[model samples]
Target: MLLADPNNPTGTAVDLDALEQFAQALSPECLLILDQAYCDFADGERAGRGLGLAQRLPNVVVLRTFSKAYALAGMRIGWCAADPEILASLEAVALPFTLTALAQAAALAALDQEAALFAQVQTTVAQRRRVRQELLAMNFEVPPSEANFLWLPLGAGRLVSPSGARGPGSACAA
Candidate 1:
């Protein structure tokens, strides 16, 4: 089995060529499990990558949620694309009904407004760039991000408030 997060913790996305290379490197019979929870945030036109991989590689499985980009975080609904055997296994262990009525309705509404919400996503990305630049100017070792949140590592397990005081590690996570 192989697991891939094209957009890793650093928010770097794999292009179609790279994705194809990764898939080709694996034995066709081996399983490729892709957790693409944040994939839509990755800017680019790699529309056919996942579907292409699934169509060509029988052992590949793609799991996506009706959350995140859809902003339907409260919905427990998710979808998976894979070979029939893999889908059957999923069905066997799947819960009776993971999503409630309201969640389903919310997901549908979100889909209806996906475009408008995508503009919001673009705004968030733009803000991420501004914040990253500010952090870099302050001599922070911020990774070049391609996603929503930023991760800052405090080497000494410390924290700094806007008031300019340093504290302990627990404060950061909290």
Candidate 2:
């Protein structure tokens, strides 16, 4: 099973306890792949728990990307945490030197600036909440979000103007 925590587009997340319970319920043969690209924005227990989950569950692999919170989208740098055996198995079939020198250096630098990284994440979370509130005030039905982006699930053939006016026909040009 593949899951994106603090899910992209919608920005909803499952709590740690719920995640553990769900993992426990899964079959032994099931491999749970957790994509935590935007997990830095998650609050309380849901934040920074991917490595712990990977450590506790043999069938779980936690994937992380530097693209989102680290502001390294152009680098295309990513990583995964899993059981040693699982990692070894993956390494056996993986190509070598996938990371470039510049990207590697940038990733190391990003890790070194954890304080700034987290501060940016907090700012983003605040801005996200503000944007959600503004959209709600304008009568846009925005679901609660935990990521950097917001999801506007527009109803079929309904367009809402900034002044809370709803019009018929699809507002999307495409």
Candidate 3:
């Protein structure tokens, strides 16, 4: 099974204890793919736990991307953590030259400037809170976000487009 923690769109993170239970329940034959693309934005306890779990569980694979926090989307660099044999299996099918030389340098440089990079993440988090509050004040229902984005679920009869067109049902189906 594959899951994105601090999930995309909604930005909700599963509790660590619950995740552990889920991992423990999975059969050895079952591969659990945990995507930690937004893990850097999550709080301390939640971040890197999947990697730790992957280190311990042969069936677990934790994937993370440098796109978001490292500001390296253009580089298209990503990485994964899993048992050595699992990684070897993945490496067997790997594409050639997928990671550019410049991307590696940038990612390394970003690592060197961790404090500055994380400060930017914190700024984004603060802005997210402020925007969520403003949206809530305007009567839009905004879910609490741990990721960089916010998810707003419009209710019935409350969906309106920027052009003032009314949306149908409980969603703004354009």
- Could you say which candidate leads in lDDT? 2
Candidate 2 TM-score over all chains jointly:
0.86
CA RMSD, predictions in order: 4.7, 5.4, 4.5
Candidate that scores best on TM-score: 2
Q: Rate the local accuracy (lDDT) of all candidates.
A: 0.71, 0.88, 0.86
Counted clashes in each candidate structure: 0, 0, 0
lDDT of 1 by residue, 55-135 (tens): 777878877776666777767776778989888988899878677889888877877996897897788778888898999
Q: What is the lDDT of residue 95 in candidate 3?
A: 84
Show the lowest summed lDDT stretch of 10 residues, model 2. Answer: 165-174
TM-score of each: 0.76, 0.86, 0.84
Off by over 4 Å in 3: 155-174
Instruction: Extract clashing residue pairs from model 2.
Output: none
Q: Pairing residues by index, what is the TM-score of model 1?
A: 0.76
Tell me the deviation in Å of residue 147 in model 1: 1.8
For model 3, give the 10-residue run with minimal summed lDDT: 165-174
